[model samples]
Target: MQVRFWGTRGSLPVAPKAGTIADKVADALVAANGRSFADKAAALAFVEDDLDFATGRSYGGATSCVEVDMGEGPFIVCDLGSGVRELGLDTLRRCAQEGRPKEWHIFLSHLHWDHIMGFPFFVPAFMDGAKIIIHAGHPDAEQALRRQQEEISFPVPFDWLKADIEFRTLETGREYEIGEVTVSVILQHHSHDSYGYRFRDRDGKVAIYSTDSEHKIDQMHDENDFAQFFGHADLVVCDTMYSLADSVSMKEDWGHSSNIVAVDLCHEAKARRLALFHHEPTYSDADIQRMHEETIRYEELTRDTDALEVLCAYDGLCVEL
Candidate 1:
């Protein structure tokens, strides 16, 4: 199984401004001052080894769409954020090139605008003969989606869509088989509540997607049911939308977790890998990179026996398990 992140930001999308790009260019020039290279490879090597990731690359701007690849069949995705538009285009190209039927399974955490805003733009939703299954814990999931495409907001009404779209609500803790994958949902701590999904393939690879959820520091040491939900996951895609201080001090009950809390939860859960997700929207690329480094340091200080692989999720990141 492979987990791909098409978007990673929380709340809303954010693109780098012109001034940011110019700053990076200027930084790169200053770093290269009086330096000579024999070939492009040498210059590139220097940049890779010396230059900061924020100065050369971005964590990206798209919000919450993720693709979970499980061999062949219909595509399975999590959330329908702005990034889903790109996933939709890619799916269209693949379907057209291979002459295959278009089908998609979307699992939504909640109906927050950032989570469902991309559904209206999903090309498959507008294509004839396409099958789209939307799974959620919210009973009004279907109504929320339809409301987004109502005549008041979007030009195309939901009823006018050409695809065979169906919405299903999953019973918490019940496992459902979607193709060869086994999926289980768990209620999370968030405003209006959210669902965290655990997907396990036949080969025993497990991936947990838990976003728009918050955790309390006082709950970390206790034996938690949430840890069981994340147990032994090969990859735990978690909400890390704030710093530890902020998540606890000022943002209490804001329905978002910090990277430190994510590490603690994954550590308690015995998860093999932890991917910091749901990045704070106001955070710059540099801030995220520094926070990622801090998370690693914190994990090192707190880890007991097994070492967990830690990574910061970015748009276009693909992890194969």
Candidate 2:
């Protein structure tokens, strides 16, 4: 199974300013310390491996889209955030090269505007002979999508879409066999509620996608339920949108989690890896890198029988198992 992060931002999309880009360039140059690489490959390697992620690359600004491949049927996508536009174009290239299917199965966590805003710009929906199957815990998913494409809101109507689109309601706490994978859903705490998904491939490799849900820290039962949902998983993509102080005090009940809480849950679940995801929009790449470093340190200090590998998700990052 391969899980690729198309978008990693939360709430909304944001772009770096000119000064930020200039700063990265200056930092990269200073880190070189007057040494020059022999070739472009060498220079690129130095940027990728030596420099900090904030200086060498970006965490990206698109909101909440992920693609999961179980090596059978169509690829499963989580959310349809702004980054899905690029994913759609890449899917076109993949289809041309590997003869992949034109069918897509998109699972939505909720009916938030940021999560579904990219549907209008998705090129595949404008193409003929394409099939799109959208599944969500909310039965009103279709209504929300159609409303977004209304004449007053968008120039194109939902009925104008060329691809055949369908919506399916998913029951929480039930596991469904889809293609070569078994998918389980868990109800989460959020505005109007949200749903987290767990996917187990034929090879028994597991991946959990849990975002837009607030985790109660003092509640052992809630923690246990989430831990079970994440048990023995290869990867757990969690919402780490704020500092612990912010998540608990300032943004309490705002429907988000912190890296501290994520690490604890993953540790309890005995998961192999935890990918910090759904970055706060106001945070810079440097802020996220610092948070990532702090999370690693926290995991090290609180580790039990085994250590959980910590990863910060960036756009275009691919985790293969």
User: Who wins the TM-score comparison?
Assistant: 2
- The global Cα lDDT (0 to 1) of model 1 is 0.91
Cα displacement (angstroms), candidate 2, residue 121, comes to 1.1
Give the alpha-carbon lDDT of every model: 0.91, 0.92
lDDT of 2 by residue, 1-321 (tens): 999999999999999999999999999999999999999999999998899899999999999999888655786899999989998998877877888888888989898988999999999999899899999999999999999999899999999999999999999768887788899899888897788999899889999999998986766465788999999999999999999989879798899999999999999999999999999999999999999999999999999889899999999999996
| lDDT (10s digit) by residue, model 1, range 129-170 | 999999999999998998999888999999988999998989
C-alpha RMSD values across all candidates: 1.8, 1.1
Note the residue pairs that clash in candidate 2.
none
Q: Report the Cα lDDT for residue 87, model 2.
A: 88
Measured against the true structure, the TM-scores of the candidates, in listed sequence, are 0.95, 0.97
Worst 10 residues of 2 by lDDT: 215-224
What TM-score, to 2 decimals, does candidate 2 have? 0.97
